[model samples]
Target: MANHPDQPAFPFRRPNPLRPPGEFERLRAHTPMTRVTTRLGDTSWLATRYEDIRSVLSDQRFGPHLHGGAMGWVGEARTGDSLFQDPPGHTRLRRLVSSAFTARRAEEMRPRVREIADSLARAMRDAPRPLDLAAWFGYPLPITVISELLGIPQEDRKQFRAWSDTFLAVSDETLAAAAQAWSDLNAYVVRLIADKRSGTGDDLLHALIAVRDEQEDRLSESELFMMAISLLVGGYATTANAIGIGALHLLHNGQLGALRADPSRVAPAVEEVLRQQAGGGEMRRVAREDVEVGGVAVKAGETVLIPLEAANRDPGQFADPLAFDIGRAPNPHLAFGHGIHFCLGAALARVELQEAFAALADAFPGMRLAVPAEEVGWSVRLLDEGPKGVPVTW
Candidate 1:
């Protein structure tokens, strides 16, 4: 698993939090699919170009295996984690919760989302000056939204959110810590599922549990537990990151003025924000058979890393790619990724972000970062990355 002498490291560092690693642009243009070594010491085909990355993502020749093992499966197959499995398992699991995240469902939730956003915005406005928006507003907004949607008790949300924060901490930091947090999280979900069976709740979890009981052939106990864990974890983390980073981008580039001026632009502005901040993690896939990527021969069992941020900024796909234009049309960025494994919560996330930024625009039209841009720290995370905290004043 040693790196080749000439092969570049898979994840180059980013000095700027808002931008992807500088190497991505050069690599994307000249050598889109170069061989590189991951931090795991595993060699992988690094795909930077949009066309090649999108092609491999859509291709059936690849599966979720990464670095010769299941991706981040610490215990019990990470059961119900659709990210680690291939279809028809991934397909079926995704189908169970897909209805809750559809565009129509998202629209239905808009009034509630607006209510939450306005409440959080008012709290932020009332808070003491120079507060961290990421902690004070960004993270809590989505966590509360998702927790309420899932029927998690208001009191239980704090405890499980703490566990999730710990669980997301690097696995190598303290294996026991992550394991215990995960176990506690799963146990809580199981208990909550049991609680739902006796009650007549109208939340998403109650409905899902009913489906499991009525059609055991479709959903198993473990899958049910895992899906709960997945939805909670997957539901908030990325959108939370997007809110923090997107807010930072608007503050830096002065896009908030345009948003404040025109309400219709907020939705498209969210899309641009999503497109610009796609540097969190690469999509990892293992070739099931010998395949060619970007004219290079990739043998079976080889790992391929697709950096979504690189593809998002590819000048070939976007004009003035680095510039954050609020009105950027035909913005087809792979922030949520492409293909079947695309994020299941995309529609909901969009609703959250759109509502979030809109509220911020109205609450603090003059909001500005309290410190130098470079002084801001990024999260020490396994999968997604974003501003650790955004200190701002209006």
Candidate 2:
């Protein structure tokens, strides 16, 4: 089925594993905001320019709580997904949870998170060559840190990865698996919330449970359930993927040696990674009222999909956008969305990435891709995108 010229359809094939679809540049240059047909045949507006993408997110007129056939089965609860909810409820929930992810809180976690990263690095050092770093190091560090922060029991850590994958399944092809995974995860969280009431601990989950009251400042049972699920999946998945992606890029770009030689560059390097990645999918929303994005008229109830990866790589914003320069300064990329809708866990994510790459580079400065660069498989589970597995050796 051919797509209309005015409405380009996706899945847009990515002929190159590491690069976004080349059409993004063409759209950004000619029509920053144009109508798009999603893979499911739902029509939405696509926003590609850096400035326009930022504007759409920050404007309250472009809201969350998007509903359409494109969101698929997992999005049946999109209204409750903390990432897609609008205020004043979103404002209240964000304010309540902000305490747990404040800069101070993330700083406090650095020592422990670093310890986790170092431990993984040590194990990697001793293991046989050509290990799947994604399995051994990439997924483990963030999963461990998030589990600890959420007060999830040690026994529950393993299943968290599989459960979190539910958010990645945004298409009907995987609807059955997504449904089962979501059901299992939902039941687990409900049980855990019940279990937490009888205990006394200082985890985020405990804090959330204690706030559930009969009065105005309270979270409903469903809100609590959704919040917990969102945190679990959002906390670990992208960071885990980035570890592998960042490592692959660092090696491919020959920046690992520089990073190892100068420890201070790790933080900036992490920012670069996020800028380049911007997650594997577009940020979705619908206009609550009429909105003008880059001079394009977007009517109320119209869906807008912003491919942040494209925005981050916009040459107009970044100098030599494709080059991987660790020292790139004044880099204002929108890998993370802007405005009040900014990511709450941004601080915590930074802590994990900085510590992770520092520890990895320290342990194996010579580490390189085990297979040919082109051989590394990339998977796109709906909106979630990243390397499938990055096998590497020193």
Candidate 3:
């Protein structure tokens, strides 16, 4: 396989994630799918168009288990949570938690999520000037919600955060660190699983253990622990990114004032925010067979990186992709991805984002970026993307 074939160029680097060079757009327009060197040193097919992404995401030819027994790509496969599985494995795990992620279930959690959002906003109100909203609110709100739902002990949150940090710090860029973090997290989960065995609780962990014992299709010990890890880490990281980046987007676009004045707009605004700003750069999938996508033939075992941020802004799909209009109806963006791999926690994430945005709007209608937009930091190393630190003030 050629390492870096001649193709349309994109700003392909790990740093300066909040803003990539203009090359990505040029690449999408000129070459929808082409080989490019990633920060991890792997040359993968970068799919930038909307239809290509949808087709690849929905096609069963792209299997998650590309590397056989080991977790493929970002170690996410072995880390579990059904994100890496296909067919019976993914289907089964999805079924186990399907009930909890329903729209009705999320609707039920709205009040509670709002309460948490309010509490976070209240705390941020008293926060020192030029606050890091990410630390004070973004990272904790959905994390706390997930922890509460999973029945993780309140005191263990810090430990869980540490593990998650280590986990997120891994990528193709830090293969060694990623491997170590994966092992450490799996070991930690093994103990957590053992502790929860004594008696059941109302938490999801207890529910997971029940699956292990009662269900014939239950997960193995390693699978259960890793599944929990995936949920916790994925839950925390993605929501944190959305909250941080989404809030920043509102501030940048001067939407906070209008939304605060009229709270009815927060729901639709959240969808747009998620569509426009909330995402990591790309996700990895291997082409299981020779097939043409975006007019490019991808052979079996070839890799494809779906950059949601680029696609969300594709002109072919969105009329004015860069324009951040809260009332952008008919927004059929792939922010939550497409097909069966769609985010299972999408409902909960919407609830959390709506609550957080509404709370910020209510508590600090004047909230604005403490730093200039050009000065903000970005993390682009993982499956999700967001600012390094979102500084805000009211």
Per-model TM against the reference: 0.95, 0.94, 0.92
lDDT of 2 at 348: 94
2 or 3: which has the higher lDDT? 2
Clashes of each: 0, 0, 4
| Clash count, predicted structure 1 | 0
Among the numbered candidates, top lDDT falls to 1
Determine which window of 10 residues in candidate 2 has minimal summed lDDT: 65-74
lDDT (tens digit, per residue) of candidate 1 on 56-166: 888989887633222354563664354458888988888888898999999899989999999989888888999999888898889988998898888887788788877
lDDT for position 101 in model 1? 90
Q: Each candidate's lDDT (Cα)? A: 0.83, 0.81, 0.77
Predicted candidate 3 versus true structure: per-residue lDDT over 362-383, tens digit per residue: 8997889988876788775355
Supply candidate 3's per-residue lDDT for 328.
Answer: 86
Off by over 4 Å in 3: 5-21, 65-82, 171-180
Q: How far is candidate 2 from the true structure (C-alpha RMSD, Å)?
A: 2.2
CA-only RMSD, every prediction: 1.9, 2.2, 2.8
